[model samples]
Each structure stands twice: as C-alpha cells, then as structure tokens.
Target chain A: MAGLTDNANAGAGRTVISVDAMGSDRGPATVVAGIDRSARKNPDIGFILHGPRDELERLVERRKSLRDRCEIRHAPDVVSMEDKPSQVARNGKGTSMWSALESVREGEADVCVSCGNTGALMMLSVLRLRKLPGVNRPAIAVLWPARSEQEFNIMLDVGADIRADENDLLQYALMGASYARNGMEIAHPRVGLLNVGTEEHKGRAELKLAHDLIAENAENANFDFVGFVEGSDIPGDTADVIVTDGFTGNIAIKTGEGTAKLIGALLREAFKFSPLSRLAALLALTSLRRLNKRIDPRRVNGGVFLGLNGTVVKSHGSADATGVSAAVKLAFKLGRSSFSEKLAARVASAVRVPQDDETSADSNGTTK
Target chain B: MAGLTDNANAGAGRTVISVDAMGSDRGPATVVAGIDRSARKNPDIGFILHGPRDELERLVERRKSLRDRCEIRHAPDVVSMEDKPSQVARNGKGTSMWSALESVREGEADVCVSCGNTGALMMLSVLRLRKLPGVNRPAIAVLWPARSEQEFNIMLDVGADIRADENDLLQYALMGASYARNGMEIAHPRVGLLNVGTEEHKGRAELKLAHDLIAENAENANFDFVGFVEGSDIPGDTADVIVTDGFTGNIAIKTGEGTAKLIGALLREAFKFSPLSRLAALLALTSLRRLNKRIDPRRVNGGVFLGLNGTVVKSHGSADATGVSAAVKLAFKLGRSSFSEKLAARVASAVRVPQDDETSADSNGTTK
Candidate 1:
C-alpha cells in the first residue's frame, strides 16, 4: 500500500490509462500482465485498472511492477461479450467498462482502453463522452499493417455505425488523417475512399458524393485525397488513411485478418510436412520469427474511437497480454501527444469551413 | 492448314470455349499460351479464340497444341480496361468480348472465358446472355481458398451489382449453392449470409429478412443455412457458400487478395534478409513452393457469372498463362457438367416456390 502511494507520486506527470480488465476473452490476468508489460517498458505510463476490486487487486499484487504503478477501481459488474450495446447502454452502471469510461469522462485519465464487447464499449463511449462538435457520426479507426514507409495505414468507421453519408465519410477522412498525424506521426496523411474499384465513375452514388467531399476538403484539412481506392489498397502503399462506411470497413479488416491467419496456418503446416522441412523451419527460425513479428495482428491491436469527445481504444476482445500491451502503448502514445484535443481542434476547424461554404452556396441558390 | 481440319474433326464432341483474347492485360499471346496449356492437359477442350484475325492467328500458329485445337473469330475491336460498362454495353458490337459472348448465346460454345475488365464483361454478359428466369440480379461467384475439406468456399455477388435486396440475396444463395454442387462436387452446401456479426439480431434489416428466408428454404433447397457469417468466415470452414451484396463481397475478396499478397511479399523479404536466411530458404525451397502453390491466387483464378442465361468465367485482367489456364479449367469443368442448365433449373424451381408462397400469404392477409 505504501509502495502504491510512492508509485502514484512518481507517476504524477505520466499518462494515466483507464483500462477495463474483466471483459477480455483471456480474463483479468492477461489485462494485468499487459499493463505490467507496458509499465515495465514505459515508466511514463500508469493505470487505473477497472474490474472486481478484490480480484484485480490480487492480480496486481502478484506483479511488483503493476503493484506500484497501478490503482484498482472497484467495478463489481462485468460487461460480457454477449451483452447487447443497447442493453448495456441503458443499464451498464457499475460495470468495469462503464467505470473505465467514467475515469476518462471525469478527466481522471487521458485515454481509456478496453477489450470488452465492441458494440457495448462504443455505445457506452458515445453516451459518456458524446460526439465531438460537428461530427455527425463518430468512427472507429484502426491501424492496418501496410507497405508504406510508416508501415501502417489508418482506416475508419470499422463498426461504430454501419452507415455513413457524404458528410459522415468526409468527417472520417478528417478524423482518420488526424489519427495518422497524431498516432503514427504522419504530418500530411494521404487519404483514400474505399470502393470496389479505383475508377472515378465506379461505386454507389453516395460513395461518389463522399469522394468529392473528401477531395474538396483535402487541401484545407492538410491531407492529400487519393480519390477512390479499392480494398487491395487498404494494406498497399496507396494511402496513409482509408475511409469507408463501417459495414465495408468492418468486412475488409475481418477478411484481411482471416486471410492472414489462414496463410500463417498453411505456412506452419508446410514447414511441418516432412523431416527436411521441419529441419529447415528450425534453421529459418530467426527469419520466420521476424516475418511473424512484422505481420502479427497483436502488434497493431487497438481500434481508436475517432470523432468522440474523449479517446477510447478498443483492443481485440480475444487479445492476449501482447495484444493488450500493444493497445495500452497506443493509448499512452495518444495521451502523451494530446490526441483527443488535437483531433477535436482539427475536426472542428475543418468541419466548420465546409458548413459555411454550403450555407453560402444555399443562400446563393447554387446548391445541389 | 491441314492440321486445322484434323483438329476440328478431332474436337467434334468436345466443349468449345469462347475466349476474349484481346482484352487481357497480357494480350493475345498469353491467352494463346493459356489455352495451349489447357489443350495439352484436357483433350476434350477446344477454343473459339476471339481477337484480331492476323494477330491471334500468329500467336495460335506458334503453339502447336492450340493450332490443332483452336478456331479464330475475327473480333477487330478490343475492349480496353478503362472502358466504362455503359459505354461498352451500348456500342461494343465488334469487340472481342461481345464476339466471345455471342458464341455462348448462339450455342456455338459451351462457355465463355475472358480476362477482360470485370464491369464491362459483366455488362456485356447480361446484355448478351440476359438474366436467367426469376433472377432479379446476377452475381459473380468466386472460389476462395479456405480451411474447408474442399479447400475452397464460394462467395458471391462479388461485383455484378453493388446492391442486393433481401430477395436478391436469396437468389445468390440458391446460385452459389448450385455452383458449389456442380463446380466443387459438394452434395449439400452450407450457405451463410455475410454480415458485420453472426448474431441473428445483428446486421441491417434486409439481412435479418434474408436470414429467415434462407433458413426457411434450407430444407427444401437441400443445403444447410448457417445464418449470418462475418467477413472472417469467408475463408474459414464455417460455411461452404457465403452470400453478400456485390459491394461487401467485392471489398472482402480484394482485401483478402491484398492481405495475402502483402504477407507473401513480407515472407519473401524475410527469407532474403540475411545470408543464413538465404541458405535456409534454399533448404526449405520445396516446402515454400508447396505453401505457395496452396495459396497461389492463380490456382483459383476465375469469377463465374451466375444467374446468366449462359456460363461466363471472368479471369483476372492481369492473368498470365497459369492464371488464364486456371480460368479455362474452371470454365471447362462447368461446361462439361452442364452447369448453366442445372443452375437455371435450380434457381427457377427454388425461386418460383418462394414467390408462390409469398403470393399465397398475401392473398391470405398474412404478409409482413
């Protein structure tokens, strides 16, 4: 207890990450271990672990690093993966996810991290933090491993809402660019609208409208609009930011993950096919490990809820310690960089000018 | 010249595949090489090669296998990759793609194979062959490499139309199941509707309606209905046929292809990182080759146009000889099985009953 106070004093200027520890598939132990891993590598990170106080305290007590740097918040109820978003939103008080979000809402923590049900977390986030001003629909932006120099591309609206109009998509482009700038340190992100094809005349009517809107705002928003991009461009070097409605974005990311996993499984099976191959696998261990590390989904586990008043990172529900750590690291990075404020400022400033222009056009009788 | 007569007589009872040779990214030479390869392995397959008379003749003449088993159709105009579907549909009378489809429409060829622009090819197909009876929309069903025992899963509406109503999705299920039965030799295909989540209560309104509709038809259709599959399940063993609108399906497939390609590139980079890795790669060459062969995009390189009056296989536009050969192989398989006739019968029979039931329900004042 004395050591905990001392650790809190030492972590006074560090970023405090609010974490929901009970809902992950692997349980609270993995979350505790993850924060411990993060705390070990980053002295500038502290945690407010939310779960059943007694159970979480014991888990944190076992880890010396976490015992010092972490504070347990008593949240008796848990938000299970099966909990409906609407149900959780209405009666989710005292739950770990709710308490974790409360810390961020009350300005006690910089960013919140959760491995809970995505829909529940999102619904709670919107209810607690609310949408940023001028954002019609908030987006969940995830970093996808790419061939770019940055090695990762930001894509948005991955399930916050299944629908997005022209304006909503434009907001995603702005928010995605901001995420790239703050999270990935890209000063001027190149954004692409995801479509079935790259051609100008292709895709649905709304996409074409969204494409134009995004392109119109690119110069003012300080990002490059690369026009229409296909799903293949999500992992390619074509864009630093990929924007789409949640339905398409969600399917694309899941499809990408499934394909990668299948390939990895097939690769392992190939190596174990015969005695010679097995020997080769041992000899090529370092190389294989490097490749695995490069493409491991755990390395990029967090999906940042963009266009919200406060930052919330939704870690993979099935994430293990490494995945959770990766998510916490992201939260810490975004918190240290003041990502939520910067994002708020960027979105407000960019979104205002477009509205002003549209209003003026309407007054001038030139609006479509 | 003498060999041509011998080839026609020898191929009298064989399946004559109409090929759009000029529209592919690799030109007629690759198409010639591909058909030659198919001809080498499959004696019962012949080609009505469509392209400029002199150019195709020169290419076909170079391949002894093709010269004996191929006939040239002079389609002077070529459908460029950039041509719009609307533009091509209106005035694409003399183009290689149109000429190729004409062969199928006139019953001169069993099926049509093209490495042309997907949108234009689909447009020309619908215009030339028309939609089958009771099919509101046609779908492009592709065989995706999967973890299933069949090593492939059928995913449909991959870009035929961007939108699919509840009924259209049902049509896709019926068509996709037929494809699996005829093409993959699956006696009882399990169909799944693609959604953001698997829960019955999840996804858009139409998907829910579709889920119920598909479930209702499962027993009579002779296929199991696995309701609501997510994008990850596309390549998983969860379902034999995953159904979705063209928009989501296109993005899923493209994203899968992109992710696989990225992984393949990264794997190659990993194996070439160091001297020891290079040495290990040499030792593991056979295993690596086996892995590559298993996941190779070229191995499963055709998108079959379902719900059309005649069979059409759209190969990858950039397909080389091997890829083109794969498409030809798929085309030949479907042709030999009288897949078009069976599919039309299956769809007509299944779709009619549902409509009749709906009409009866409407008359009984029990319709939703």
Candidate 2:
C-alpha cells in the first residue's frame, strides 16, 4: 500500500523515470545514452538515473549536452548477468539496482526500468514491492506485433517461475489476458495456451490439466479463451495472447530471436555474395526493415512482470542503449496506463469474500 | 519386425536402389524424374520403384527411356502420414513404406528410404531393426554443414524421445560425436551441450548434473567436450557436434526452418517491390540457392533413431521426391557405414564388462 503511494508520484509530479543504471551491457553509459536519446526525444519526461555516482557523474559530466536534462541518484551496487537472481537482492545493497528499485517503491520515480538479471529483479521486486492480494507467483508478459486491425500478441511467464501447476498456468492466462485488455487496451483479447500441439493429449500432463481446467471451469470470462497455440503460431497472426510456462516460453522467445537474426544475417550475406545480389540487397533494404520492424526485438522490449501489485518492466538485461530506452518509454506509458490497476481492481472486485470455491487454501485465503 | 522386413524375392537378384514410390510431394513422377535424371547422370546406381503397379506402371510408361533401367514392385496399401507407427507396422501388410523398410531389414535391399511420416518409419524401424546394446534411447541425428575444417555440425535426438534424462542427453552427445567421427566422418569431434549459458548453473537441474557427470567422466576424453552452446553459436562454426533433448531439438529445428523461410520470403518480396530490385533478384538467384543450400533442411534428410538395437531412419513425413531420395541415400550410407558398430565395439572394448564404476548413478542416485 505504501509502495503504491510512493510510486504514485508518477501520476502528478515530474514523471521521474527510474533507470536501473546499474544494469545493461555497457552499464551507466548505455543507460545514460538511452536517457539522453529519450530525453532529447520526449520533452515532457524527466529521468533519474539510479546507480553509483563516480561513473554516473563521469557519464553526466562527459555528456555535457545531457547534464541539464538528467539527474543521478547514487546507489552503490550493480547486479551482473551471471549473478544468481536469488542472491542479488541482498548482495546489491547501496548499488544502483537496489536503489533504483527502491526509488520506484519509494515513489521517488513514477516508473522503473531494468535491463538487468530478470530473476534477480523478480525476486527482489516480488519481495520488496510485494505481490497483489491474491497473486501467488508473478509472471512476465510480452507484447508482439500480430496483424492488421489488431495490435500484437501477449506472451506470458517467460522464465518467471520454473514449475507451475494447472492453476498457476491458468492464473497466468488470466493475468496476461487482463494485461492485454488493460495494458495494450485490447478489448476482449483472444487468449491461447501454448502447447506442443493443438491435440488435447499431445503435451505433458500439466498442459492437459491446464487446458481442461481453464476451458471447463470458465475460470476467467473477461477475455475469450482461444484454446491452444502451437509453436508455429507464435509468429503467425493467429492468437492475440499466448501463454506458457517459464521453460517453454524462454526457449520459444530465444529461438524466435536467434532464428530471426540468423535469417537476417543470411539474407545480408546472400545479397553481398555477388554484385547483382548486392544490387538486390540495396533495393530490398527498405522492405526488409519493414519486416524487421514487425519482429523487431526493440518494439517488443518491455516485458511486464505480471501479477504484481504495481507495474515492473524487465528489459532484456543485455539490451543495448536503444533497447533500454524503449523499455523506459514503455514503462512510462504503462505506468500511466489502466492495465494493471484495472486487472487488480477486477480481481479485487470479482472476489469480494471467500466462496465455497476459494482459490487460496486454508485460512490464508487471498484478497477475498 | 518381420512385417516391416523387405520382401526377399522382390529386392533380391537386383542391383537397384529401392525408392518408396508413394504420394511424395510432387508425387512419384518427380521421384521417377529425379531417378531418371540421376540415372542419366550416374550410370552405376539403378532404380527399383516400390508402390502399386498402376502408379509405378504409369510412371515407367511416362518415362519410356527409363523403363528398361527401372523396375516396379507392387504393394497396394498406402501409409498415410497420420497413421500411428504401430499401425504402420501392423497394417504395413503390402504398403510401399513397409516394402521399403522390409527390403532393408531383410538384407534384400542395400538401404530403404521413404519421406513418409517420421514417427511411423521410426516406430517400425526401431521395432524391427533394433537398437544396439548400451544405446538407451535412439536419437535422430542430423548433420549441418558448418564453416570449419570439420565442415559440418551434428545435432542429435531431434525428436526421438520426449523426455530424456542425463543419460539420454549424454548419449545424444556421444552418438552425435561418433556420427561426426564416422557418419560425417570427422575425427576428434568436439561435443557441446546446448544450454542457455555455458556455466554449470545455466540450464535445468538435469543439464547441470549432466554437465558435471560429463566433465568428471573419462569417456568424454575420446572427443573434445566443448562445454555449452547457445543458439547464436549454431549459425557460427562452433562445435563439431551439439546435443540436446528431443523436444528442444525438434522445436529448434522447426523454428530454424520456419524462420529461414520467413526471412527468405520477406527478402524476395522486398526485392520484387522495385523494378531494379526485380532485375537484381533475377540475376542473383544462384547466390540465393547457395545460401539456401547452406541452411538446407534437405541436406540432412534422414534422421536416424540412434542407440536403437538396430538402425532406423525417420524421414520427414511430408518429404517430397528430392527429400525422400536424400533420405534413402542417407539410410544407405548409415546402414553401410560402421558408425554404430564402431561405437558399440569401442564402448565394449574399452570396458570389458559393466564395472560398477563404469556406470555410476548421479547425485540423485539416478543413472547418468
């Protein structure tokens, strides 16, 4: 509750965008470059870069052009990609990452953006920022370009939780669907569970159970649950929201990203191999960019840590300056957006008191 | 097993390649055409078309010049792609697929190839041909041409067993390495386990345990254990052989295939959008083919169900004339080659008997 109030300053104040300056490939420089680029682009947004000072000061002092527009908050720690997610929250004391997270939780910044270790962020945030009343485990949700007359697809739980039961998976779908409705503002977003196959008996027992539970129980009627989606369907403009567990989702995302980049590289090499092909490559560069934009990792940079009380955007820890910038921009937009608040509100409103079918077990029931 | 065996009289007294003449994409005509073309090109290898008399007769009649060189064997039943592997064996009765498999199994034919349903072929063959001793789970090994001295990379157990333990995964690496040694026939094959990261803590519990087990074990000394490989390394000429569980491997293969096609299509459409680009595309078709060949799925058509008591090749269920032809070619090479025999022989030779230390259980007391 206090955490919400702290971050709530985002609505009325200077709109301070919290930068997890401690994270990212090139660290402070990358985040700073992104902030500079974004600040130059958006006049209304103010940024507070969170990290230890010497580098931040050097960065700000070095980039004289950005000094007037940006400010740095000193946090002493930095979480490396290799750092264990579980251990980092404790170890990253006084570090920029910890402070940046604190800034958002403390309401010093309206939004928080991190291109840091995802597991660390989740572990830290879930404990620090706290989970929503009924939410047990949090899930990560991503937005992908789908088709015309539709915005993009929503994918969930990308390496958030290792093991999920049927209930956890369905809850993920509900959270993701609610995210689509509120975050992207898609009305009645079609929901689909990712499966090895469309056949009911195809995947593991967990998937089969999840499918049956979701479909049979009329679990969440807010969105149209659009059944199962095969791996191929992720790229295709079929389902608006795709849901899967951590392992499969992470692999799917990486495979898609790797495969796309590989093809692009091949195309580049192919076109350059011969003079005539070079000519074609030059001619086709524009069209290729358009295609690239559709699948551009940047356009889909901000992955929301769903089921949390507040919005937390986990940018790919290895994201470049531009990618991190996009993530910050998304968080700013999402912070103001009606997605999570509405989802939480709906969840809160739907379960006024404990029913015969209480989702939570024992006397430790949820928001109910 | 007998049902899947090739007819003795049919394949005997002949020096011909048994083609599973069925409804391969582009049909029997293309196969006859490819055979006609290859036969025209190479005088040594003759053709024995196996299918219904009417279709084979029509094909032979259509190519009058090849009628003298090619022979037709009649088998009425057709193995539909959807048919279960068990059903294929039971109902193989007189199908071309059955005839082809039986032909090879019975030693009447040098090798049998069919681009029919991969599962059915795998099931029939693994049941019939049998896995070699010490081969726990048979893997479908594929060799990818790499940009290195070895010139190719081996990926195994693409889609054999759904869930594999450390043993299965490690066996995949061993089988793949052996394949690199003898199938692709590259010596000192470097084996890498595909993972999210190269570190021990990168993958699942099984992967972690597998990594330690492989490192501590002496069997890996026979080949170079190159540690973990991410998806990006796949495009580069990294390791000689990469091993993964069948689920991830299958998904990755499909993802790679689909992404390549997607990118290729995008590049073409982009090129054709402009007049000059169109002209360039027309001239650079060869370069495109060269690129395609490098990532050609067909180049590695026959995926063997390795570790089986016998040899079984699972070709693409939807394979066309060329794909099926390649599968047959692969089967002939694998069946004739001493890859498995050498592996069995080596394992047996090195360890005279199953010493308790030779096959130690992992930390979980589960066999690695």
Candidate 3:
C-alpha cells in the first residue's frame, strides 16, 4: 500500500496534478496528451493519472519521458457518466475518477482536475474534502461570457447550491467577488445580481429581497456593487462579478455553452450557402480567426467549484486535449493561489449561521 | 371616450396588429421597416403603428401601400428600456408600447407586438389581462436554439415568474407541452424537466419532486414524460417540452441567446483568418447553412407567454419587421387554434389537487 501510494505521490513537490484519466470525451489519450503538453509548458509540474493501469500503460507506451514525469495509480472500477453521484460515491471504491479525487482529499495531489460527471465529482469532493465550515453550499463560479472592459465576471450558484436565499446569494456575491479579486486577481471587483431588467424591483420577490440585501450589504460589502445587470450583461462584461441562484446561473451558463456550439454549427452552414457568401467569408478570414480564438471554449476550460475547502476544478466532460490542458494549467494556477485557503476561511467566518429553511432532507433532490 | 374607443376598434374585423413603433436598438426606423414588411407580407393582417403620430407619419411618407396598410395610432410617450416596470407602467399614459398592449387588452385589435422593455410589458399585461383564476404565475415559452426532430423545444418562464415552486413548474410543463401540441401543432409533446443531470437523483429538491410528480402525473399526466434534460439537451431537442422555474428558464434562454451572438462573432472571425482556413470554410459552407437554418432564432421569433387567458407572443426585443411578422403569425396561429383555452383548461384540470403540496393561493392546507 505504501509503495503504491508513494508511486502515486510522484507528484509531490512539483505542482502535483491528479487527472481522472478515464474521464472526458476522448478519455486518457486526451488527458495524457494534455498533461504531457501542459507539463512541457510548465516544467515545474508533475502528474498522477488515475485510471485502469492497462489502459494508461498502453497509451503511455511510447511516451517514455512523459511516463517519467507522470505515474499511473490503478483505480480498478470506472464510475460511468450516467451513474448517480451518491450511488457512485457510496459504492465507487476504486473508480478512477474517485481515486483522482481521493488523491486531493488525502493531500497526495496538490490539485485535482477531472473531465468526468461534474456533479459526481462535486459530490465526491464534498464527501471527501469536506465543505468549508460556514458556507452552506458550493457554487459553480464561472467567467461570464462578457465583452465589457470588466470581462472577468465571476458569476456563481450555477447549480452547486439549489435553494439559495438572500443570504445565500450574498455569500455567492462575496465568494464570486473574492474569486474575481483573487482568482482572476482583479482589484475591487464589480458585482451585479443577474436580473430580468436593470430595475431593482424587476426580478422575483427573492431577487428583490436579494437586491435589497445586496444593496445594503454593498455598503459594507467586501466588493464593489455595481447595481443590477440583465441577461445581455452576461456577455457584455457589464461588471466584474455577476451573482444568481444555482438554477438560473446554471441555465444561463449552459445556454451560453450550447449557443456557442449552435453558432459554430450555423456559421459553417452560412459559408456554404452561396459563392458570394463564400467569397465574403474568405475575404473576412483574418479578423475571424481572432474572433474564434477569443471565443474558444477550450481557452477557458476549467470551471471552479467555489466555496469548497480546496481547489476542485471541473473541465468539460467532452473536452479534447486543448480543453484538458487548459484545465490542468488552471488548476495549477488556482492550487497555488492563496485565494482558496483565504477565501475558504473567510467564507467560513463570513457565513451567517441562519436557520436552515427546511430540516427535512429533500428526498426528491434527484431528477428522474 | 366612446368616440375614441370606436375609432380605435374600427379595424376590429381585420387582423390589425398594434406595433410598438419604437425600436429597442437603433431607434424607430428599424421598427417602421419591420412593421411595413409585416403589413406587406400578411395582406390579410392590418397594422396599427403606435408611436409619435408625426414621426410615424414622417417615416410612413415613402411607402404608398404600407401607408394605407399601417395607420399610426399616435402615442406621445415612449418607455425607456431602463425604467422599472412598476414605475414605467404607471408613468406612461399613452406610451406606444403601453398603448399597443392596451389594444390587445381592449380587444380593439387581434394582437400587439413590442420590441421594448420586456419587464414593463409583462407587468402591464398581467395588470390589464389579469392572471387566470387558478394561475399563480405566467411564463414566457420560447424555442430553443438546439436542433430537434420537433424543429424546436418549448421552454417556459423565460424571465417571468422567477421564484416558482413545484406547482408552478408543473403548470409550466403542462403549458409548454400544450403549446408544443397546439401552438406547434405537435401531438403528445414529450415533457422534460431541465436540470443538472437526467438521473433521478440529480436536480434541485423541487425539480426532483417535480420529476416524481410528473412521472406519477405521467401515469395520468397529459403529456409524455421525457424525464430530465441538461443544458445541452435544450439545443438537442432532448424533449419537445422543457419546463423550469422562471428564474432558470430566463437565464438559460438568455444565455443561449447571447452565446449564439458570441459564437456567430467567433465563426465569422474563423472563416476570415487565413487563406487555407477560408478555403476550408468555403467547403464547410453547406453544412454551416444547414446548421444556421436549424438554429435560426428568428425562425421562431415569438415566445408565447403560456398560461395566459389569450395568446400573448413576445418577440425578441430587437426583432425587425420579419420577426414581428412571424410573431403576429404565431399569435394568430395560437389564437385560431384551441391552444390557449384548451391548454389552460387541461393544465388547470390536470394539476394535482395539491394534496399535501397545497401550493395554491392556500398553502396552509394540512399535509397527508
């Protein structure tokens, strides 16, 4: 056990990264390629790829140098994409994704990045790493697809916490603001609550209440409150931070994601329509490449599950090598940042110990 | 008042649409163009161009046939995009948008369309139309950008009814299903609850509970239960009908909207960047065109605010003449169909009598 674990700890000292080799669209090949590519980019980092030993061995056969820089930790079972997080966590003893998460939990890895069932990864991380004491829920804080000067909006509650109230939203605002300040390393991050309209009274009762709470909190709020933002602001970089409930935030983020894919599909078709359009597309080539790079989802691959005790980054489940590589780099940057521990402790201290809305554990917490 | 009202209802027999002659983006010219185009396309439908009579008349001077088809209703005030709904609704006497809505409320016109402040429009509509007796909330149901065999997915609570519960979600599901069935004229619309995952254990407690309610209701539920769908599914047509709380549904729809814009921008850049890429784009043009048609947001320009007593279709705020025309056509189709009356009655009847989940105007009812 010691020998095996030690081998897994080859990631020690160097920014040790544990990749869920079995996770994602292309599996270990992509993960391995990404890890190797990223390792080459940053010589200071090493990795432990968690998956079936035979598969990793086969993929790594020709990559001898990469093998030296990385080690494989055998995780016998593979948790599937469709498995229930709780069910998987409860029964998944040696699943690759599980072991990758366990590596971080046990301090064997400095950062854990996985392109697996995001919710499952989240559940496992919470069960193993423990939630920061005060924060009731961990949110999925993301970079709002903004175009404004403050392009780095840290929008939160993208489904990690479901029934968030005014206080929960405040925590979200604070956590997101902290991330903007620390993660993006922006100073005096500007925060806005995502509303239907710019008016304070424009949203639902909770949004109104949250608006008031946020407004009052903003007087003493850790970050700068830039008032409210609308859906259009998500991509406009209207503010450095945007906050909303997990349900709304999740929908908004995914909508952005799916839309991006849809547009890509559309543009390809648009160019094929007529020779004139074809000429126009050809003529506009230079500017288009820059635009493509600007919106490349792969460039910003890892989405952090904020308010956790440590760094737990989720890459796209269907990510290719570029996306996984970006996730690795992101995890590295976040793992070494003081924001994780500082914000975790601050959030723990800052969290208002309000009464739980409902004591009865939601039996219907899962979707059928 | 009687004389003015009589003049207003002069075209009652004609399919005259009251258009808010104000442009949300580049000002009134675009709106005028849109209305003129609508009047031209649907000769059977008349146009009530509501705005500054002078500006509208001035804009209408050139179009000989459009001048006759679209008569200006002469509204003095315009609703600013930034104004609060509560304030704006009260402050505006005969704002073009307000006046247009009034036409619908008064039944002076068959329908009205606005590319104005959606918040104000919703508020005014609810105030004027009054929600159905059993209806606690109204929702905006729109077509998703994803490709579907059904051609589109109906998503509700776009931005209205933000803080919704299980009952509200259930109503949304039923209404969305009905809209798909009647509005799109599909049969046995597949209803899906949008969530983080499809597993029974995946969404928020309310959704999980809703899923069970839907599944249970499924045994007797009016629509086909397609279970839970993720963000990706919205674009994939995973279900014919997708239901969620207003808050989430709004964000999801908007995210898709903004993201499509962002990606469109990216693809334009990609096709223009270099020579080889440009040629490749030319080759890929055919596929791109097919993709565009598949995801044309304008093709389904109007989003029906379901659960309303009448078909109230909201077009994209920046919709031009073609979009508004499409919306009018949609409203007419819905109005003519047994959709609104039948759907409302079905949903109202189909709703579980809230045994223990008495989420009605009365929630104090005892649980089983």
Highest DockQ: give the candidate number.
Answer: 1
**Model 3 / residue B42 / CA error / Å:** 3.1
Candidate 2 segments whose C-alpha is farther than 4 A from its true place = A1-16, A39-46, A53-71, A108-110, A133-136, A143-152, A217-221, A317-321, A345-368, B1-18, B37-48, B61-71, B143-152, B213-221, B276-284, B343-368
TM-score of every model? 0.93, 0.84, 0.80
A154-213 in candidate 3: lDDT tens per residue? 678788866688778877887887777666777777888988767665677777787766
Model 1 lDDT tens row, B1-368: 54552245434789889999988888888988998999999889988888888887777777877765788888899999889889999999999999999989999898999999988999999998999999999999998989999988999988889999999999999999989988889999999999998878888899999888887667656788988998899889999999999999999999999999898899889999999999889989999999889877799899999999999999998899999999999999999999999999888777755445543435432232
Q: Whose lDDT is greatest here? A: 1
Candidate 2 vs candidate 3: which has greater DockQ?
Answer: 2
Q: Residues B310-357, candidate 2, lDDT per residue (tens digit)?
A: 455555656655666666566555545744466666444323322344
Please give the distance, in angstroms, between residue A89's alpha carbon in candidate 1 and its true position after superposition: 2.6
Model 3, docking class: acceptable
In terms of lDDT, the poorest run of 10 residues in model 2 chain A is: A1-10
Task: Count clashing pairs, candidate 1.
Answer: 0
Task: Sort candidate 2 into its docking category.
Answer: acceptable
All candidates: DockQ: 0.84, 0.36, 0.33
Looking at candidate 1, what is the lDDT of residue B124?
90
Fnat of the models, one by one?
0.88, 0.33, 0.51
Where does candidate 3 chain A have its weakest 10-residue lDDT segment? A359-368
